[model samples]
Target: MYEATDHPDDDVVAIGPADYPHVRQFVRPTRRALLLASVKERRDGGGEGSLYLLDAAHARRLLAPERPVELIPIPTAYRLDDLTFAVVQGLISADNALGADDRLLDAEEQGLEQHLQRERTVYAREAVPGLSQVGAAWLGSRFCSRHALRWLTKNGAPSALWSRAQIGEEVLPLLLFRQQHQFIDEFTKLAAGGDEQPGVVLCVPEDVVAASPLYQRILFFLALAWLEMRGLVTWVCGEPEYAKSDEFVLVPGEQAVIGTWMRAKDNIWSADVAVRKAQVRDFDLSVRHARAHSVTQGGSSHARLRAAVEYLGLEQTWGTLPRRCAELGAYGTVDMLQSRSRLIALDEVDRALRYVGGLGSA
Candidate 1:
C-alpha cells in the first residue's frame, strides 16, 4: 500500500475478486518486542514469565550480509542481561556471534558485571502499535512522554521506563495465562467465539505504525499471523498512505493476514512459500526449534520436519529413491510407492507428497 493516500474505514479491508485465497502475515517492530524469553518463579507460588522487550539491533547486525554472524560480538549491554537477571544471554539468536574479541571481552564483561542490567528500558525502544509493543503505546498514550511518539516512531524517538508486564500484556492472556505451548491454538482461539470478522483492518495513525524498515517483510508476516487469529481474516491500512485507489492496507487475493499465521503452523499445499515468506520465519524460532528437538529426540523426527525436507528435495534425488512396499507388491519410485503395478509420473510427485505424513520412527 502507498504511504500517501490509502485509508480503510471498514472493519475488514474489502478484498478484490482478483485476490482470492490469498493470505498475509503481520510484522513486528524490528528494533524491539515484548518477548517471553525467560520465566521467574514468584515467591507466592506460581512462576511468572520475565518479559523482555529484546533489542534486536545487535542480533540483526550480526546477521547482516556484510558480516559473518559468528564473528560479530554481542554488545556488553546484551551479555549483561544474562549475568544479572540470570536471563538468556550471549546469543539471543542462533545466528548471533558466540565469541567476542578475547582482548577486550574480559574487560567488557567485568565492567558490565554491575551495570549490565536493562541498561535500556522498554521506553527507549519505539514499538509498533497493535503488537506487544502495544504496551508502550497504550501506556504512553495515557501519559506525557519524553520522546515524540511517532504518529508511528521509526524516525528514532525515545520511549519511557521499561516494564516486563508490558511484554506479557497481550500474549499471556492469549496463551491462557501460561507460557506458550501451541501457537496455532493460541491464535485460533480468537475465532472460537465465532465472532471472527473476515479480517481486521487496522486504522493506525502513521506515528503508531512502526518507523523501522524491515529488510525481511516475512518478519512482519510472522507477527501479523498472531493478529489474524482474532478473525477469519486480517487486513491493515495505516491511513493516508495505504488509502490509495490501486493499493490497500492489503487487499483481497492480496495476502490476508489470517492465512499467513496458518502458514507458520501448518504446511502449505503448493509448497512454494512467499519470497519474503521465502525463508523460514517464526515469532520465536527458539520455541519452534525446541519443539523440533522434542519431536526428534522423542523419536518422532520421521514425522516432524522430514516431510518438509522431502518436499524441498533437500536430502534425496526425487525420482531415484526406490520404494518397495514389497509385501503389498508395489515397487516404484519413492513418489510412486502406492502404484500397485504401475509406473509413477514424475510430474505428479508433488501431488503425491502433498498429504504425506510421518516416515515412522527411525
Candidate 2:
C-alpha cells in the first residue's frame, strides 16, 4: 500500500508486497510505487479520488488490454470543475472537428423513438441485427432491465447498444455515435500499424470498489464516454444504421454561437426573449402571423418554419441562434434542420423551408 505525509521531499511512501499479499502479482515496481502513492493520496483526501497523469506506457499497463491506449494531457487549471469542463469541451470540439455531419448523434433529432419501436418488433423475432448468440441469450436473460433499455432509447444511440456483443453476466451500457465508431476504427488501425500512440488513464481512489455489477457498469459507461469524447476509444459494435435522412441544410455563417449558448452558465432568458422578438421582426408579416397562430393553435409545423427562418436570420445577424434556440427549447428542431441541410443539394433558404416542412411530415 501507499502512504503520504506532509514532508515535501518524502510526500509518498511505497509499501512492498510483504505488507499486502493480495496485491496483483504482475504489477511492476514503478507501477507499484505509483499505485501506492495514489492510495496514500486517496486516504489522506478522505477517500475522494484524485486524478493522476499517467504516461502512455504506464497507461497501457494499467488500462484494459482489449483496446489500444493513448494518453492525452489534462490542461493545468485552477479549479477542478474547470478542468472537467475543459475535458468535456475538448471531447465535443474533437467530435465536432470530424465535420458537422460526422459529429456525435443526438437522440432527440435522430428518430430514437422509431428505432426503439423497431427494436420491439426485432425482440419479438429473436433475431436482433447486431447481437451474437451469446449476447442475444444474455439480453434475453432477466438481468437486462426495462429501465436501462428505456434510458438507452430516450437518451443514447440505441443502434450502438443493439450492435454490440453482450456476453458476460454483467452488461455495461454502450452510448456512441456512428462517426465515433469510425474514429475509433481509424485509431485502432493506426495503432496496429506500429504508430506510437498515447492514451488516457483515469486515476481513482484505491478504496473505491468498482467490483459491484451495477457500479462497474456505471463506471464502465462513464469511462467509455469520457474516452469517446477525447477520441481515444469506442465501444465495440457493428456499424449502426442511421434512421434519419442524410440531407442537411447548411447555415453559411458561424455555428459557434450554438455551442456558446449550450455552455453558458448565466441566465440569458430575458435577453433571449428580446433577441427572439427582434428575430421575428425579420420575417414577413404572413410568416409572423403564422408563427403567432401556431403558438395559439398548437400547430408545430408553422412554429418550426418560423424557428428555421429565425435561426437563419440569427445566422445572418452575427450569432444569435444559440440564445434564441435555448429560449425556445428548439435545439432538436434546429439540429434536425441543420442535419438535413448537410444531406442534399438545395439553396440555403429553400433547404431550410423544405427541412422544416419535412420535419413537420416526419
Candidate 3:
C-alpha cells in the first residue's frame, strides 16, 4: 500500500494503484465533465479528508481539449502494453492528478531497467567469442529480427557494437552512464564553461536515456539522418519546424537525427530512418526539458496542492493541512521545489489564510 506523501503545495494528485483505475477513466477530452465532477465533489467536501481545489477554468485551458495524445514509440512491441500507455496517460491526465510536477525518477528508472534488460537479452543470441550463446540466441529471438540486423549492417553499426563489445568494457558502462541522466550536470558544466547552443536544444536527463528500447532509439536516430539528408532541419540545426506547416508536426527525436545527418559527411541514410521519421517532432523537445526539470524536482507541488483543494474542499481540505503542508516543507531537491513554486506557480499556504480565510478560501 502506497501512502500519499505530504505535498500541499503541489498541483497534481498522487494516487496509489487503487486510485489509478478511477483516475484512468477520466483520461479523455470528452470526459472533462466527469473529472470536473470529481474535482467539484472534492471542493464541496467529499471522500478523502485531505484535498484542495484548483481553478477549473484555468485547468481546462492548460490541459487544452484539442491537444491529441502524444505517442511515445518504444523499441519493442512487448513494451507496448496497456500498463505502459497507462503510465504515460497518467502522467498527462490533469494538472491536479498528473500535472507537470511529481518525481518521474521512478518511471525513468523503470524505463532504464527495461532498456538494459532488453539490450542484454537481444545480444544474448549471437555466438559471442566468450559469452552466453544460448541467452544471446533467446534474446535475439525475443527482440531482434532479420530486419534489425540489416539495418545495423547498413547503418553505422549501432547494434553490431552490442554484439562485439564485452558487457563491462563498452556496452554496460555506457548504459550505466545514461547520457540523458548526466545531461543536466553536463549542461551546468557546459554553461559554466559558457558553451550554450542557440539551436533547439533537446535536453534529457542523464538518468533517462531514450535508448531503453534500442529499436526505438535506432528508428529516431536514423529518421533524424533522413530528414537531414532531405535538408529539412538545415545544416546549422537551429530552425524550428512547427512554424513551417500545420501538416508537418515534427514528432520527438526527428529533428536531432536530421540535424546530425545534415552535419554528416557521408550521409548514409539508415532504413530505420524510414521506420522512425514518422514519429519525430518538436513536442519532444519540450517534453525533454519538462522531464529533466521534473526529475530534479520531486513533482509539481502547486499542482498537487491545487488538486487537494479541488478534491477536499475547504473544510475537508483542512484535514490534509498538517501533513500536506509539512510534505511541501520537506520537499527535497532544487528541481522538485522549482517545479512546485516556479513551474506550477504555487503560493505558500499562509497559516493566517488557512485559519482566517476559513472554508471559503480553499
Clashes of each: 38, 18, 50
For model 1, residues 1-362, the per-residue Cα lDDT tens digits are 10111112321111222221121111123422211122233224576522222233433443455664322221112111211121122012211111112233233224422321322222222222222222222222211111111011222211111111111112221212111223223323332433222232322223432342221121222222233322223223333442221101111121211111111111110011111332223212322332333211222323323432332222443121212111111211221111111111211222112212112212
State the local distance difference test value for candidate 1: 0.22
What lDDT score belongs to each candidate, Candidate 1 first? 0.22, 0.25, 0.25
Q: Candidate 1: misplaced stretches above 4 Å?
A: 1-190, 195-211, 216-218, 226-232, 240-362
Name the lDDT value of residue 1 in candidate 3. Answer: 17
Candidates 1 and 2, the one with greater lDDT = 2
For candidate 2, write residues 299-334 as lDDT tens digits.
Answer: 333333333233222224214322322222221222
Local accuracy of candidate 3 as per-residue lDDT tens digits, 40-147? 123235664332222223233434547522221111111222222221222123222212222432232233334333212222112233222222222222122222
Q: TM-scores of the models, in the given order?
A: 0.19, 0.19, 0.19
- Candidate 2: C-alpha RMSD after superposition: 22.1
Query: What TM-score does structure 1 among the candidates reach?
Result: 0.19
What C-alpha lDDT does candidate 2 achieve relative to the native structure?
0.25
Deviation in Å, model 3, residue 295 alpha carbon: 26
Give the Cα error of residue 53 in candidate 2, in Å: 14
